[model samples]
Target: MAPVRIAVVGLGKIARDQHLPAIAANPAFTLVATVSREGDGVPGVPHFQSLDQLLERGPAIDAAALCTPPQVRHELAAMALARGTHLFLEKPPGATLAEVAALQGMAQASGATLFASWHSRFAAGVAPARSWLAGRRIDRVQITWREDVRVWHPGQAWIWEPGGLGVFDPGINALSIATHILPQRFFLKSAVLEFPANRAAPIAADMHFCDTHGAPIHMDLDWRQTGPQTWDIVVETDAGRLTLSNGGAVLALPDRTERDEDREYAGLYAHFAALIRSGQCDVDVTPLQLVADAFLCGRRREVEAFED
Candidate 1:
């Protein structure tokens, strides 16, 4: 079978760090081109100032991966699907649930695979952690995803924008993993958002959620932490404690034994390749739905200004 020809839209930090490397490593995908405004063209591949130009001039690419911000994902996704190409979208599929649903409809009608890739759900230890929790009763869960954005994101301007998602960007990853590992479907109970005084979006958020069966999950997200970085999710159950650290890369059981390394992006692309080959679609919006519910119900509080 021929490798799927892939073109990536939005050549930002994630596209550089995760998507490109994953595509390069995957035997089923070929990096054919990229769409970027500044045009840091990928070597031996074409670069376009926008998706419009890429679609107009590039070779026959089978799939288009959107690494752009959530706000604009809908239009790009719709365009690709209409052009008879499969799509791979970054997390937080679209700015609004309505848009994602619309894209799903269009994809089905067009017979194109629409994959909303939540990379964190593909973490190295996620599979094992999920299996461990399957038979046990989950009691409580706590998630903390705090990092110094200046160190990790640097001068990324879109992060603080209205539709850029701010701190929830990382927080959503935790939600995705939590949703995947938990046996029961959950709903939001309450939330509080801490918006930067001078910014349009929140810099921190604290959310509380519960399952229909009454399992409580608490989430804390901050972009201002400066010390040793922390990205962890701990679940305490009737059996024992299951801690997934380094953003689900390391899974440590209660007995102090740890397992595996990170393979988030690689796993996502592998899934994407398989979906495209098998004529299937994978779009899980539970995490993004939680985010939307929080935004809809939470009261906003203005906090200290953040500048990169």
Candidate 2:
């Protein structure tokens, strides 16, 4: 079968660092064009200032990976789905749950595959972790995801805006893995969101959740850590403790520990290709729903202003 002709909309850090490379490595996809408001694109592919320009004058594409910020994703996704172009949405899907749901409806009407891609759920250890926890009794879960925003998201002012998820942008990745691995469904109990004095979004958050079985789950997310970063989830089960570190790249169980190379993006693209070939849509909104709930029920606290 011929490779799926794909375009990448958004040439940001993630597009360059993960998306492009993954598409290149996957023989099932061919990069036909790229779109971004600023900065150069792939050396040889056609580049556009906006999705409108691409759709108007660029080569035909079978699919597009929307790497743009969540705030503006719904429009681009709707445009692509309208043209029957398969869509690969980066994490958080959209700024609002309703918009994403609307996009899903559009995809269904257009018969286009819409994949709300969650890279973290594709991490090497995530599948194994999910398999291990399927039959085990979950006692509790603790997630600590801390990183230096200055180091990771330098000069990204949009992240502090109303539609930008801020700390929850990264926190949602953890939730994606948690929701996938944990057997029972979970719901938020209470949350405390710490916003920087000068920013519209929170820089840190502490959340408490409970699974259907009454197991406690705690999450601590902060974007202010300076030194070595931390992304870990510890789950206490009846059999033993299960731990996933390095954002689900490493897993430790009672018998042994497993670590694997970073292949999250590659896995995502592979799944996208399969979905396109099979004529299906995968738009799980559980993680996004959890974040929305956190914002809805969270208590607000102001912290020192952050500058970057």
Pairs clashing in candidate 1? none
lDDT, model 2, position 113: 98
TM-score of every prediction relative to native = 0.97, 0.99
Q: Which segments of model 2 are wrong by more than 4 Å?
A: none
lDDT of 2 by residue, 1-308 (tens): 99999999999999999999999999999999999999878899999999989999999999999999899999899989999999999988999999999999999999999999999999989999999999899989999999999988999999999879999999999999999999999999999999999999999999999999999999999998989999999999999999999999999999999999999999999999999999999999999999999889999999998889
For model 1, how does the per-residue alpha-carbon lDDT over 10-84 read when each residue is reduced to its tens digit? 998889998999899999999999998886769889888988788888788899889998887888888899988
Candidate lDDT values, in order: 0.88, 0.95
Off by over 4 Å in 1: none
lDDT of 1: 0.88
Pick the TM-score winner: 2
